[model samples]
Target: MQSTLSGRGFRPGDVHTLIVPLFHVTGLNTIMPTAFHQGATLVVTAQQSPRDILALIERHCATTFFAVPTTMILLAQTPGVEQHDVSSLRLIAYSGAPMPLRAIQRLRELFPGVRLHNFFGLTETTSVTTVLPDEQALVRPESVGLPPPGIELKIVDDHGDPLPANAIGELLVKGPSVVKSYHNRPEASAEVIVDGWLHTGDTASLDEEGYLFLQGRKKERVIVAGENVYPVEVENVLTRHPAVAEVAVIGRPHAILGEVVKALSCCDPTPTLTSGR
Candidate 1:
């Protein structure tokens, strides 16, 4: 899967520096496997700070770097990063979160010889669901790129019926890399996998050229301070209150956390509680 999905992005003898967790899908399925399959060198290091990362790259003569957007931002915007000789880098790939335009531009300036790529995937897909190649990295930054060869994608509305291109809807994926079920999670497996298609909970759309663009999430989950918060779980607890009659939970933007859960509710009319009483 990694060999075919990676295409020309990886080659024999290329040096890869491991920054993302090895246990995660991006590292385990995509980075490590693809590197070994292509006979590339893998450098396992724990240095995370911007200066440390820059030093590691220069020391190892690393050709590839894969990390989350936050880490990439720090690396690209580090003070005096240009002083380091990082010319050996051939590829810089990121996933697991969105990259800001400011960081992307800075990275372009920081490494003109490196190819910047952004991929999108879930742990369920075992990584590399879509890869925004270097050519489309800036052209369609909003799009997660076309699915690799042999992957099938479909967008469906609330009713589970398919929607045409450019229509935002729930994203469904089917491919060899997709897991059939979850471990010891029958209910979760049933909800996520249907007729061989993995219901990715994320809301997305495809353009006329088949480039995918994620809109948001359609499921009950939100990310607050890097924590997964299920709105249903919160709503379940909130309904236990005597004064609460109804509630609707969702996620709102947060400057630092990326997203925070917000719940709207209506109190019981007969037992209305006054604020600050």
Candidate 2:
């Protein structure tokens, strides 16, 4: 991974570029500010093709990059990505949702000398609370990471007591970056923001090392055999099959187990499964 500081040292006037969706928080927070804060140039594009992104980076000599996991996948699969002069990229920050391990690995292989940081947060958190560092990415790819600077994170159980390490609980965050209230919805703010801590309904567990591993959302957890099962867990497993390109796992009613895992996969046209179904 490349150093956060460039060879010439931290340049406040450094130019960064982002090819991101306009409706999202990231575009508002990072992409649009390229010109304002750093005296950097901003490239506005209606389309998000990997080719266009690479071309922009090459044409403008963009130093910083940003995208979601989906876009990163496109970059990895896109032809001639390596042929372009993406060597100008120093930092490549990504976050919108959890990235698949395969995609993360591929990105590492593709850009072995780049810094790929993952920013994790909600709109209510003012865009980001945690930043998954590049060093921990390969070893603990599941970790969304420790809270970013100024952000305070805590995992609390049902009683509002802080849970022990590795125990899954609601993620609560407090920081200067957090939004104070929601527009025209006092009730929604009351439900989420409690004494400065914003209750993010996203379930997560912090390891002893303090890296946060996101589970499914509280509302999305499936109840099966009197146990909680996250669909993302099963989906990740099923997608490991060579034939499966994408997968969605749901809990379905069963005669004995109360509910069983039902996996739906978008497989290749010519498919083969080793599992005896």
Candidate 3:
């Protein structure tokens, strides 16, 4: 946690505002410890309201803030957001889910001076394995950034063969932070951890610079006409539409194709379905 924050320019005497639930891994492992290690003030709230969060940032002069993409979207779109004083914030990091490019652009516009970070990791890894810094957030909006020091990451095919750059495969990670096994659940742990490497279950690809880009979860892939469709890829495209508030893509059974992509979206008014193909 300290390494994650320090690498991102967190300093002593900074203030961090956290709205994520303490029961979640992000709250327990990442935010709290990071703040404590940096000697920074930590302000936490049980509320998930965007308005309240904005207010907290101003009231506490929060220098660092972390939240999920959904929360960031809400905060960006919430009414009277501009009325709140968030000038104190210097860093804003998001994780736990895929963030739409629109939301990222919105944040950049709202907080031009603030640095944006995209963090990627799981509970087993003890917080973050990769961090997409503000410098690259806009240039490579889809990447989850490069891995930190002391961590080893790889993309491997089903047969455990290592894949080259840009080849989509299961993301495997090994490092000091990775937990060896789940307490008293050896069988369950075995399914994910093999040879000291934790199978993240996330299908991803690495660029030539070793920056990881998530495709989607292995279980979330839909095979349509023997072609795999990653839900996140479809969701990212659908979210580009102005009418879409949020979206989820899934596979529906199709007699001929085996499965077909189905998108469900939340919008202000009913959207007219149009087929380009």
Candidate 4:
């Protein structure tokens, strides 16, 4: 939490709004602790309504806001967003899922001066491991940025061999923040934490500059015939279509092919492609 606050330039006495559920790692571990550590006033919201969120920010002059990509998308799409006075916001951090490029662009358009950060972490890591800083938000929008403070990230193949840069492989993370074991789940913990490194189960690639680009979850891979298909890759391509509002890809059982890639897409104006499925 301290690492995240310091890395993102959050200062003491900042007003932070917490909209994410407290059960989640972002809320319980990251946002909450960070706010307390910085002596920031926290405004908690039970629901995720855009109106309420906007009202709280305007009412309390929130300086820092943390939410998932879905909530950010809703806020961007909500009507009358311009009426709210969100100029006080200094930092806006998003996590839980990979943010769409259009959503990032829309947030920039909506809040011109606010710093946007893309945070990446899991429950086992105790919250954030990497963050795409405000300056690099537009430069490398797809990357999750370099590891935060004490964290170390590496990409490794199935056999645990280190892969070269730009090779998509399982991401291994090691740091002080990583949990040593799961609560009463020793077997599960053993499977994930090997030596001092935690197997993140996420497929990603690292560039020469050490920026991480997530491909997708390794468990979400679809086996089509003998080929391995990553859902996020397909979703990224489908989202580029102008009509696509949201998309999720999965594997469907096929007798001959073993499995087939299937995509479920939501279109803005009820696209013609809806009939065939």
Deviating ranges (above 4 Å) for candidate 4: 270-277
Q: Which runs in model 3 stand beyond 4 Å of their true positions?
A: 268-277
User: How does candidate 1 score on lDDT?
Assistant: 0.81
Better of 1 and 2 by TM-score: 2
**CA displacement after TM-score superposition, residue 228 of candidate 4 (Å):** 2.0
lDDT of 4 by residue, 194-266 (tens): 9989999999989999999998989888889898788887888888676789999999999999999998988
Q: Model 2 over residues 1-277: C-alpha lDDT tens digits?
A: 0112221122455556666676777777545643465466665666578888888888888877777788887787776678888777777778887677777788888777887787686878656667778887778877877775567889998789999999888899998878899999999999999999999998888999989888878887778878888887777677666677677777788888788878887775656766783
What tens digits encode model 3's per-residue C-alpha lDDT throughout 1-277? 6567655677889898887788888888877787788688989887688888888899999998988888998877777777988999999989988887878998988888999999898889988889998999878888889888878999998899999999988999999899999999989899999999999999999999999999998998999999888888888787778778789999999999999999998874655645751
Clashes of each: 0, 0, 0, 0
lDDT tens per residue, model 1, 194-251:
9999999887888888888876677656879987665655665665565775667899
Question: In terms of lDDT, which candidate is stronger, 3 or 4?
Answer: 4
**Candidate 3 clash pair list:** none
Please report, as a residue range, the 10-residue window in candidate 1 with the lowest summed lDDT: 1-10
Global lDDT scores for all candidate models: 0.81, 0.75, 0.87, 0.88
- TM-score, cand. 3 vs. native: 0.92
Model 3 accuracy (lDDT, Cα): 0.87
* TM-scores for candidates 1 onward, in order: 0.78, 0.87, 0.92, 0.92
